[model samples]
Target: MSILFGLLAVIIVLAIAYAMSNDRKNVNFIGIGVMLLAQVLTTWFMFMTPIGEAVINFISDIFNKLIEFGTEGVNFVLGGVTVEENASVFFFNVLLIIIFFSTILSVLTYLKVLPFIIKYLGWGNF
Candidate 1:
Protein backbone atom coordinates (compact mmCIF):
# COMPACT_ATOMS: atom_id res chain seq x y z
CA MET A 1 0.00 0.00 0.00
CA SER A 2 2.58 2.57 1.15
CA ILE A 3 5.15 0.96 -1.10
CA LEU A 4 3.00 1.76 -4.12
CA PHE A 5 2.98 5.45 -3.28
CA GLY A 6 6.75 5.36 -2.73
CA LEU A 7 7.23 3.78 -6.15
CA LEU A 8 4.87 6.29 -7.74
CA ALA A 9 6.82 9.15 -6.16
CA VAL A 10 10.12 7.79 -7.41
CA ILE A 11 8.71 7.31 -10.91
CA ILE A 12 7.31 10.83 -10.98
CA VAL A 13 10.64 12.32 -9.82
CA LEU A 14 12.60 10.34 -12.40
CA ALA A 15 10.12 11.32 -15.09
CA ILE A 16 10.52 14.99 -14.22
CA ALA A 17 14.31 14.73 -14.22
CA TYR A 18 14.37 12.97 -17.58
CA ALA A 19 11.92 15.46 -19.01
CA MET A 20 14.03 18.40 -17.87
CA SER A 21 17.38 16.97 -18.97
CA ASN A 22 18.58 18.66 -22.17
CA ASP A 23 21.07 15.90 -22.99
CA ARG A 24 18.69 13.04 -22.36
CA LYS A 25 20.67 10.70 -24.55
CA ASN A 26 23.70 11.13 -22.32
CA VAL A 27 21.79 10.22 -19.17
CA ASN A 28 23.28 7.11 -17.64
CA PHE A 29 20.34 4.90 -16.76
CA ILE A 30 22.66 2.16 -15.50
CA GLY A 31 24.32 4.57 -13.08
CA ILE A 32 20.91 5.72 -11.84
CA GLY A 33 19.84 2.09 -11.35
CA VAL A 34 23.04 1.38 -9.46
CA MET A 35 22.52 4.41 -7.23
CA LEU A 36 18.93 3.41 -6.41
CA LEU A 37 19.98 -0.15 -5.61
CA ALA A 38 22.86 1.08 -3.48
CA GLN A 39 20.61 3.47 -1.58
CA VAL A 40 18.04 0.76 -0.88
CA LEU A 41 20.68 -1.76 0.14
CA THR A 42 22.48 0.70 2.39
CA THR A 43 19.21 1.69 4.09
CA TRP A 44 18.30 -1.96 4.61
CA PHE A 45 21.74 -2.73 6.00
CA MET A 46 21.66 0.22 8.42
CA PHE A 47 18.10 -0.49 9.67
CA MET A 48 17.70 -4.25 9.48
CA THR A 49 21.06 -5.59 10.66
CA PRO A 50 22.64 -6.11 14.08
CA ILE A 51 25.90 -4.80 12.60
CA GLY A 52 24.09 -1.50 12.16
CA GLU A 53 23.92 -1.11 15.94
CA ALA A 54 27.67 -1.61 16.16
CA VAL A 55 28.24 0.88 13.36
CA ILE A 56 26.05 3.43 15.17
CA ASN A 57 27.99 2.90 18.39
CA PHE A 58 31.31 3.23 16.58
CA ILE A 59 30.25 6.49 14.95
CA SER A 60 28.97 7.78 18.29
CA ASP A 61 32.33 6.99 19.87
CA ILE A 62 34.17 8.87 17.13
CA PHE A 63 31.97 11.95 17.65
CA ASN A 64 32.46 11.73 21.42
CA LYS A 65 36.21 11.66 20.95
CA LEU A 66 36.03 14.60 18.55
CA ILE A 67 33.94 16.55 21.09
CA GLU A 68 36.54 15.88 23.79
CA PHE A 69 39.24 17.14 21.43
CA GLY A 70 37.17 20.24 20.66
CA THR A 71 36.61 20.88 24.37
CA GLU A 72 40.33 20.61 25.02
CA GLY A 73 41.02 23.13 22.26
CA VAL A 74 38.42 25.55 23.70
CA ASN A 75 39.89 25.19 27.17
CA PHE A 76 43.34 25.97 25.80
CA VAL A 77 41.98 29.23 24.30
CA LEU A 78 39.55 30.31 27.08
CA GLY A 79 41.10 28.77 30.24
CA GLY A 80 37.78 26.97 30.90
CA VAL A 81 34.03 27.23 30.33
CA THR A 82 30.99 25.14 31.11
CA VAL A 83 28.01 24.56 28.87
CA GLU A 84 25.76 25.87 31.69
CA GLU A 85 27.27 29.40 31.80
CA ASN A 86 28.88 29.97 28.42
CA ALA A 87 27.62 29.67 24.83
CA SER A 88 31.25 29.17 23.80
CA VAL A 89 31.02 25.62 25.12
CA PHE A 90 28.18 24.87 22.75
CA PHE A 91 29.96 26.65 19.91
CA PHE A 92 33.14 24.66 20.52
CA ASN A 93 31.28 21.40 21.00
CA VAL A 94 29.19 21.65 17.83
CA LEU A 95 30.43 24.28 15.41
CA LEU A 96 34.15 23.79 15.97
CA ILE A 97 33.77 20.02 15.71
CA ILE A 98 31.99 20.52 12.37
CA ILE A 99 34.75 22.84 11.14
CA PHE A 100 37.41 20.41 12.30
CA PHE A 101 35.67 17.50 10.58
CA SER A 102 35.24 19.54 7.40
CA THR A 103 38.93 20.49 7.48
CA ILE A 104 39.91 16.84 7.75
CA LEU A 105 37.64 16.05 4.78
CA SER A 106 39.05 18.94 2.79
CA VAL A 107 42.59 17.72 3.39
CA LEU A 108 41.58 14.23 2.32
CA THR A 109 40.05 15.73 -0.84
CA TYR A 110 43.19 17.73 -1.54
CA LEU A 111 45.21 14.53 -1.18
CA LYS A 112 42.88 12.82 -3.71
CA VAL A 113 42.20 10.11 -1.11
CA LEU A 114 38.51 11.02 -0.80
CA PRO A 115 37.78 10.83 -4.50
CA PHE A 116 39.62 7.53 -4.79
CA ILE A 117 37.66 6.11 -1.86
CA ILE A 118 34.35 7.57 -3.03
CA LYS A 119 34.78 6.30 -6.56
CA TYR A 120 35.03 2.72 -5.38
CA LEU A 121 32.26 3.04 -2.80
CA GLY A 122 29.96 5.21 -4.90
CA TRP A 123 28.31 4.87 -8.35
CA GLY A 124 31.46 5.86 -10.25
CA ASN A 125 32.44 2.37 -11.36
CA PHE A 126 28.91 1.51 -12.37
Candidate 2:
Protein backbone atom coordinates (compact mmCIF):
# COMPACT_ATOMS: atom_id res chain seq x y z
CA MET A 1 0.00 0.00 0.00
CA SER A 2 0.95 3.65 -0.32
CA ILE A 3 1.24 3.95 3.46
CA LEU A 4 3.80 1.12 3.54
CA PHE A 5 5.82 2.82 0.82
CA GLY A 6 5.72 6.13 2.72
CA LEU A 7 7.06 4.46 5.85
CA LEU A 8 9.75 2.69 3.85
CA ALA A 9 10.77 5.98 2.24
CA VAL A 10 11.09 7.63 5.65
CA ILE A 11 13.24 4.76 6.95
CA ILE A 12 15.45 4.83 3.84
CA VAL A 13 15.98 8.59 4.15
CA LEU A 14 16.80 8.32 7.85
CA ALA A 15 19.28 5.50 7.13
CA ILE A 16 20.98 7.61 4.44
CA ALA A 17 21.19 10.60 6.76
CA TYR A 18 22.62 8.48 9.56
CA ALA A 19 25.20 6.98 7.20
CA MET A 20 26.31 10.41 5.93
CA SER A 21 26.30 12.22 9.29
CA ASN A 22 29.78 13.27 10.53
CA ASP A 23 28.90 13.08 14.22
CA ARG A 24 26.86 9.89 14.31
CA LYS A 25 27.69 9.30 17.99
CA ASN A 26 26.20 12.72 18.92
CA VAL A 27 23.06 12.33 16.76
CA ASN A 28 20.11 12.96 19.03
CA PHE A 29 17.49 10.34 18.17
CA ILE A 30 14.99 11.84 20.62
CA GLY A 31 15.12 15.26 18.96
CA ILE A 32 14.76 13.71 15.50
CA GLY A 33 11.73 11.67 16.60
CA VAL A 34 10.11 14.67 18.25
CA MET A 35 10.57 16.83 15.16
CA LEU A 36 9.12 14.10 12.90
CA LEU A 37 6.15 13.71 15.21
CA ALA A 38 5.66 17.49 15.23
CA GLN A 39 5.68 17.52 11.43
CA VAL A 40 2.97 14.87 11.27
CA LEU A 41 0.81 16.58 13.89
CA THR A 42 1.17 19.99 12.23
CA THR A 43 0.18 18.52 8.85
CA TRP A 44 -2.85 16.86 10.40
CA PHE A 45 -3.89 20.03 12.25
CA MET A 46 -3.71 22.21 9.12
CA PHE A 47 -5.89 19.94 6.97
CA MET A 48 -8.25 18.62 9.64
CA THR A 49 -9.08 21.48 12.02
CA PRO A 50 -11.78 24.11 11.51
CA ILE A 51 -9.57 26.89 12.87
CA GLY A 52 -6.85 25.98 10.40
CA GLU A 53 -9.40 25.88 7.59
CA ALA A 54 -10.63 29.36 8.56
CA VAL A 55 -7.08 30.70 8.59
CA ILE A 56 -6.40 29.25 5.14
CA ASN A 57 -9.70 30.53 3.77
CA PHE A 58 -9.06 34.01 5.13
CA ILE A 59 -5.68 34.20 3.40
CA SER A 60 -7.16 32.78 0.20
CA ASP A 61 -9.89 35.38 0.25
CA ILE A 62 -7.39 38.20 0.68
CA PHE A 63 -5.31 36.90 -2.25
CA ASN A 64 -8.38 36.50 -4.44
CA LYS A 65 -9.49 40.04 -3.67
CA LEU A 66 -6.05 41.43 -4.49
CA ILE A 67 -6.00 39.57 -7.79
CA GLU A 68 -9.48 40.78 -8.58
CA PHE A 69 -8.44 44.36 -7.92
CA GLY A 70 -5.41 43.89 -10.15
CA THR A 71 -7.56 42.55 -12.96
CA GLU A 72 -9.88 45.49 -12.63
CA GLY A 73 -6.98 47.90 -13.09
CA VAL A 74 -5.70 45.93 -16.06
CA ASN A 75 -9.11 45.80 -17.68
CA PHE A 76 -9.67 49.51 -17.15
CA VAL A 77 -6.87 50.36 -19.56
CA LEU A 78 -6.71 47.32 -21.86
CA GLY A 79 -10.31 46.26 -21.89
CA GLY A 80 -10.59 46.70 -25.68
CA VAL A 81 -7.37 44.81 -26.38
CA THR A 82 -7.99 41.27 -27.65
CA VAL A 83 -5.52 38.41 -27.57
CA GLU A 84 -5.38 34.78 -28.64
CA GLU A 85 -5.09 31.82 -26.25
CA ASN A 86 -1.72 30.70 -27.67
CA ALA A 87 -0.18 34.11 -27.06
CA SER A 88 1.09 35.85 -23.91
CA VAL A 89 -2.32 36.72 -22.47
CA PHE A 90 -1.55 34.99 -19.19
CA PHE A 91 1.73 36.88 -18.92
CA PHE A 92 -0.07 40.20 -19.24
CA ASN A 93 -2.52 39.16 -16.52
CA VAL A 94 0.32 38.36 -14.11
CA LEU A 95 2.08 41.56 -15.10
CA LEU A 96 -1.05 43.51 -14.22
CA ILE A 97 -0.99 42.14 -10.66
CA ILE A 98 2.65 43.12 -10.23
CA ILE A 99 2.05 46.56 -11.71
CA PHE A 100 -0.94 47.21 -9.45
CA PHE A 101 0.99 46.04 -6.40
CA SER A 102 3.98 48.22 -7.26
CA THR A 103 1.79 51.26 -7.82
CA ILE A 104 0.20 50.83 -4.38
CA LEU A 105 3.58 50.22 -2.81
CA SER A 106 5.01 53.39 -4.34
CA VAL A 107 2.08 55.44 -3.19
CA LEU A 108 2.34 54.02 0.32
CA THR A 109 6.06 54.68 0.42
CA TYR A 110 5.52 58.28 -0.68
CA LEU A 111 2.93 58.79 2.04
CA LYS A 112 5.22 57.23 4.68
CA VAL A 113 2.54 54.55 5.35
CA LEU A 114 4.91 51.65 4.74
CA PRO A 115 7.25 52.62 7.56
CA PHE A 116 4.38 52.90 10.01
CA ILE A 117 3.13 49.46 8.98
CA ILE A 118 6.59 47.89 9.13
CA LYS A 119 7.32 49.46 12.49
CA TYR A 120 4.12 48.13 14.08
CA LEU A 121 4.49 44.72 12.46
CA GLY A 122 8.09 44.48 13.67
CA TRP A 123 6.96 45.31 17.19
CA GLY A 124 4.21 42.64 17.01
CA ASN A 125 1.55 45.26 17.77
CA PHE A 126 -0.78 43.62 15.26
Candidate 3:
Protein backbone atom coordinates (compact mmCIF):
# COMPACT_ATOMS: atom_id res chain seq x y z
CA MET A 1 0.00 0.00 0.00
CA SER A 2 2.81 2.41 0.86
CA ILE A 3 4.69 1.48 -2.31
CA LEU A 4 1.59 2.09 -4.41
CA PHE A 5 1.16 5.56 -2.94
CA GLY A 6 4.86 6.35 -3.45
CA LEU A 7 4.68 5.28 -7.10
CA LEU A 8 1.59 7.39 -7.62
CA ALA A 9 3.34 10.41 -6.10
CA VAL A 10 6.34 9.91 -8.37
CA ILE A 11 4.14 9.63 -11.45
CA ILE A 12 2.29 12.80 -10.54
CA VAL A 13 5.51 14.71 -9.99
CA LEU A 14 6.95 13.48 -13.33
CA ALA A 15 3.81 14.51 -15.13
CA ILE A 16 4.00 17.97 -13.61
CA ALA A 17 7.66 18.33 -14.59
CA TYR A 18 6.91 17.21 -18.14
CA ALA A 19 4.09 19.71 -18.42
CA MET A 20 6.29 22.52 -17.09
CA SER A 21 9.25 21.76 -19.33
CA ASN A 22 9.78 24.27 -22.17
CA ASP A 23 12.12 22.14 -24.30
CA ARG A 24 11.43 18.52 -23.48
CA LYS A 25 13.19 17.32 -26.62
CA ASN A 26 16.45 18.96 -25.44
CA VAL A 27 16.55 16.90 -22.25
CA ASN A 28 19.66 14.73 -21.91
CA PHE A 29 18.63 11.32 -20.64
CA ILE A 30 22.23 10.22 -20.03
CA GLY A 31 22.97 13.27 -17.87
CA ILE A 32 19.76 12.66 -15.89
CA GLY A 33 20.73 9.01 -15.34
CA VAL A 34 24.22 9.99 -14.17
CA MET A 35 22.85 12.56 -11.73
CA LEU A 36 20.32 10.04 -10.39
CA LEU A 37 23.03 7.45 -9.89
CA ALA A 38 25.24 9.98 -8.10
CA GLN A 39 22.36 10.94 -5.79
CA VAL A 40 21.61 7.30 -4.97
CA LEU A 41 25.24 6.45 -4.25
CA THR A 42 25.76 9.57 -2.14
CA THR A 43 22.64 8.75 -0.06
CA TRP A 44 23.72 5.14 0.39
CA PHE A 45 27.21 6.06 1.55
CA MET A 46 25.96 8.82 3.86
CA PHE A 47 23.73 6.35 5.70
CA MET A 48 25.83 3.18 5.49
CA THR A 49 29.50 4.14 5.72
CA PRO A 50 31.51 4.47 8.97
CA ILE A 51 33.03 7.81 7.99
CA GLY A 52 29.58 9.14 7.20
CA GLU A 53 28.34 8.02 10.61
CA ALA A 54 31.23 9.79 12.30
CA VAL A 55 30.60 12.99 10.33
CA ILE A 56 26.90 12.88 11.26
CA ASN A 57 27.73 12.39 14.92
CA PHE A 58 30.18 15.29 14.85
CA ILE A 59 27.57 17.62 13.36
CA SER A 60 24.96 16.45 15.88
CA ASP A 61 27.35 17.22 18.72
CA ILE A 62 27.96 20.72 17.40
CA PHE A 63 24.21 21.35 17.07
CA ASN A 64 23.55 20.11 20.59
CA LYS A 65 26.22 22.42 21.97
CA LEU A 66 24.74 25.38 20.12
CA ILE A 67 21.29 24.56 21.53
CA GLU A 68 22.69 24.40 25.04
CA PHE A 69 24.42 27.74 24.60
CA GLY A 70 21.19 29.30 23.34
CA THR A 71 19.25 27.86 26.28
CA GLU A 72 21.71 29.37 28.75
CA GLY A 73 21.35 32.82 27.17
CA VAL A 74 17.57 32.51 27.19
CA ASN A 75 17.56 31.47 30.85
CA PHE A 76 19.78 34.42 31.79
CA VAL A 77 17.55 36.94 30.02
CA LEU A 78 14.12 35.47 30.75
CA GLY A 79 15.02 34.27 34.28
CA GLY A 80 12.79 31.43 35.53
CA VAL A 81 10.35 31.90 32.65
CA THR A 82 11.83 28.85 30.95
CA VAL A 83 11.32 26.61 33.96
CA GLU A 84 9.23 23.47 33.60
CA GLU A 85 6.28 25.22 35.19
CA ASN A 86 6.23 27.90 32.47
CA ALA A 87 5.36 25.99 29.29
CA SER A 88 4.54 29.11 27.27
CA VAL A 89 7.82 30.82 28.09
CA PHE A 90 9.73 27.66 27.23
CA PHE A 91 7.98 27.50 23.86
CA PHE A 92 8.82 31.15 23.24
CA ASN A 93 12.44 30.50 24.06
CA VAL A 94 12.50 27.72 21.47
CA LEU A 95 11.22 30.16 18.88
CA LEU A 96 13.78 32.76 19.96
CA ILE A 97 16.59 30.31 19.17
CA ILE A 98 15.70 30.68 15.49
CA ILE A 99 17.02 34.25 15.52
CA PHE A 100 20.37 33.09 16.81
CA PHE A 101 20.54 30.29 14.24
CA SER A 102 19.52 32.58 11.39
CA THR A 103 22.17 35.14 12.31
CA ILE A 104 24.82 32.45 12.19
CA LEU A 105 23.47 31.23 8.84
CA SER A 106 23.58 34.76 7.42
CA VAL A 107 27.18 35.25 8.52
CA LEU A 108 28.14 31.93 6.97
CA THR A 109 26.41 32.86 3.75
CA TYR A 110 28.26 36.16 3.61
CA LEU A 111 31.51 34.25 4.02
CA LYS A 112 30.57 31.95 1.10
CA VAL A 113 30.97 28.90 3.35
CA LEU A 114 27.34 27.86 2.92
CA PRO A 115 27.45 28.21 -0.85
CA PHE A 116 30.59 26.07 -0.94
CA ILE A 117 28.90 23.41 1.19
CA ILE A 118 25.77 23.46 -0.96
CA LYS A 119 27.86 23.12 -4.11
CA TYR A 120 29.69 20.19 -2.56
CA LEU A 121 26.29 18.59 -1.88
CA GLY A 122 25.33 18.83 -5.57
CA TRP A 123 22.65 21.48 -4.99
CA GLY A 124 24.71 24.55 -6.04
CA ASN A 125 22.94 25.29 -9.33
CA PHE A 126 19.88 26.69 -7.63
Candidate 4:
Protein backbone atom coordinates (compact mmCIF):
# COMPACT_ATOMS: atom_id res chain seq x y z
CA MET A 1 0.00 0.00 0.00
CA SER A 2 2.74 2.44 0.89
CA ILE A 3 4.60 1.58 -2.29
CA LEU A 4 1.46 2.22 -4.30
CA PHE A 5 1.00 5.64 -2.74
CA GLY A 6 4.63 6.49 -3.27
CA LEU A 7 4.40 5.63 -6.92
CA LEU A 8 1.22 7.65 -7.28
CA ALA A 9 2.84 10.63 -5.63
CA VAL A 10 5.74 10.46 -8.02
CA ILE A 11 3.42 10.16 -11.00
CA ILE A 12 1.43 13.16 -9.87
CA VAL A 13 4.51 15.33 -9.54
CA LEU A 14 5.82 14.26 -12.90
CA ALA A 15 2.46 14.98 -14.48
CA ILE A 16 2.46 18.47 -13.08
CA ALA A 17 5.95 19.09 -14.37
CA TYR A 18 5.04 17.75 -17.77
CA ALA A 19 1.92 19.87 -17.92
CA MET A 20 3.99 22.92 -17.22
CA SER A 21 6.47 22.18 -20.03
CA ASN A 22 4.22 20.60 -22.64
CA ASP A 23 1.52 21.68 -25.08
CA ARG A 24 -1.98 22.56 -24.01
CA LYS A 25 -3.51 19.26 -25.09
CA ASN A 26 -0.98 17.18 -23.22
CA VAL A 27 -1.47 19.36 -20.17
CA ASN A 28 -5.21 18.78 -20.30
CA PHE A 29 -4.74 15.04 -20.56
CA ILE A 30 -2.25 15.12 -17.77
CA GLY A 31 -4.71 17.02 -15.62
CA ILE A 32 -7.43 14.44 -16.24
CA GLY A 33 -5.00 11.63 -15.61
CA VAL A 34 -3.97 13.15 -12.32
CA MET A 35 -7.56 13.48 -11.20
CA LEU A 36 -8.13 9.81 -11.91
CA LEU A 37 -4.92 8.88 -10.14
CA ALA A 38 -5.89 10.89 -7.10
CA GLN A 39 -9.27 9.20 -6.98
CA VAL A 40 -7.71 5.75 -7.12
CA LEU A 41 -4.96 6.49 -4.66
CA THR A 42 -7.32 8.06 -2.15
CA THR A 43 -9.66 5.11 -2.45
CA TRP A 44 -6.84 2.67 -1.87
CA PHE A 45 -5.37 4.58 1.03
CA MET A 46 -8.52 5.70 2.80
CA PHE A 47 -10.98 2.84 2.28
CA MET A 48 -8.57 0.02 3.08
CA THR A 49 -7.60 1.19 6.55
CA PRO A 50 -9.13 1.71 10.01
CA ILE A 51 -9.03 5.44 9.30
CA GLY A 52 -11.51 4.75 6.54
CA GLU A 53 -14.18 4.04 9.13
CA ALA A 54 -13.57 7.36 10.84
CA VAL A 55 -13.50 9.11 7.49
CA ILE A 56 -16.88 7.64 6.64
CA ASN A 57 -18.26 8.75 9.97
CA PHE A 58 -16.91 12.24 9.43
CA ILE A 59 -18.46 12.48 5.99
CA SER A 60 -21.81 11.32 7.36
CA ASP A 61 -21.60 13.87 10.16
CA ILE A 62 -20.91 16.64 7.68
CA PHE A 63 -23.87 15.69 5.53
CA ASN A 64 -26.07 15.56 8.60
CA LYS A 65 -24.95 19.03 9.58
CA LEU A 66 -25.64 20.31 6.08
CA ILE A 67 -29.11 18.78 6.17
CA GLU A 68 -29.82 20.38 9.52
CA PHE A 69 -28.67 23.75 8.23
CA GLY A 70 -30.80 23.43 5.10
CA THR A 71 -33.83 22.44 7.15
CA GLU A 72 -33.43 25.44 9.41
CA GLY A 73 -33.13 27.77 6.46
CA VAL A 74 -36.20 26.29 4.83
CA ASN A 75 -38.19 26.50 8.01
CA PHE A 76 -37.22 30.07 8.61
CA VAL A 77 -38.32 31.10 5.12
CA LEU A 78 -41.47 28.97 5.04
CA GLY A 79 -42.78 29.70 8.51
CA GLY A 80 -41.70 26.32 9.90
CA VAL A 81 -44.44 24.49 8.00
CA THR A 82 -43.50 21.18 6.40
CA VAL A 83 -45.48 21.81 3.22
CA GLU A 84 -43.49 19.09 1.46
CA GLU A 85 -45.81 16.48 3.01
CA ASN A 86 -47.75 16.75 -0.30
CA ALA A 87 -46.46 15.38 -3.56
CA SER A 88 -46.20 18.74 -5.31
CA VAL A 89 -44.60 20.34 -2.30
CA PHE A 90 -42.25 17.41 -1.97
CA PHE A 91 -41.11 17.82 -5.55
CA PHE A 92 -40.68 21.51 -5.03
CA ASN A 93 -38.59 20.86 -1.94
CA VAL A 94 -36.43 18.46 -3.90
CA LEU A 95 -35.91 21.03 -6.59
CA LEU A 96 -35.02 23.62 -3.99
CA ILE A 97 -32.54 21.29 -2.40
CA ILE A 98 -30.93 20.55 -5.72
CA ILE A 99 -30.70 24.18 -6.61
CA PHE A 100 -29.25 25.03 -3.21
CA PHE A 101 -26.59 22.38 -3.45
CA SER A 102 -25.79 23.29 -7.04
CA THR A 103 -25.37 26.90 -6.19
CA ILE A 104 -23.12 26.05 -3.31
CA LEU A 105 -21.03 23.85 -5.58
CA SER A 106 -20.76 26.56 -8.18
CA VAL A 107 -19.75 29.13 -5.62
CA LEU A 108 -17.13 26.88 -4.16
CA THR A 109 -15.71 26.09 -7.56
CA TYR A 110 -15.69 29.73 -8.50
CA LEU A 111 -13.74 30.44 -5.35
CA LYS A 112 -10.98 28.28 -6.92
CA VAL A 113 -11.64 25.10 -5.01
CA LEU A 114 -11.53 23.16 -8.25
CA PRO A 115 -8.18 24.62 -9.21
CA PHE A 116 -6.80 24.01 -5.76
CA ILE A 117 -8.05 20.45 -5.90
CA ILE A 118 -6.39 19.96 -9.25
CA LYS A 119 -3.19 21.40 -7.92
CA TYR A 120 -3.30 19.13 -4.90
CA LEU A 121 -3.77 16.25 -7.29
CA GLY A 122 -0.44 17.45 -8.69
CA TRP A 123 -1.51 17.21 -12.27
CA GLY A 124 -0.88 20.82 -13.16
CA ASN A 125 1.13 23.66 -11.74
CA PHE A 126 -1.14 26.62 -12.44
For every model shown, the clashing-pair count is: 0, 0, 0, 0
C-alpha-based local distance difference test score of model 4:
0.74
What are the clashing pairs of model 2? none
Tell me, by lDDT, which candidate is best.
Answer: 2
Candidate structures ordered by lDDT, highest first: 2, 1, 3, 4
Model 1 Cα lDDT, one tens digit per residue, 1-126? 998999999999999999999999999999899889988998789878999878988999998897787668767776775566545555656776677778878999999999999987765566
Q: After superposition, how far is residue 31 of candidate 3 from its true place, in Å?
A: 4.0
Q: Which window of 10 residues has the lowest lDDT sum in candidate 1?
A: 81-90
**Candidate 3: segments with Cα more than 4 A from true spot:** 1-11, 22-30, 83-93, 115-126
**Per-residue alpha-carbon lDDT of candidate 3 for residues 16-50, written as tens digits (9 for 90 to 100):** 88789999998676776676677669878878999
Query: CA lDDT, every prediction?
Result: 0.83, 0.84, 0.78, 0.74
Q: In model 3, how large is the Cα lDDT of residue 105?
A: 94
Write the number of the candidate with greater lDDT, choosing between 2 and 4.
Answer: 2
Model 1 alpha-carbon drift over 4 Å, by segment: 1-16, 85-93, 110-116, 119-124
The model with the greater TM-score, 2 or 3, is 3
TM-score of each: 0.65, 0.52, 0.65, 0.51
What's the lDDT for candidate 3? 0.78
In candidate 1, how many clashes are counted? 0
In model 4, pairs of residues that clash are none
TM-score, candidate 1, is: 0.65
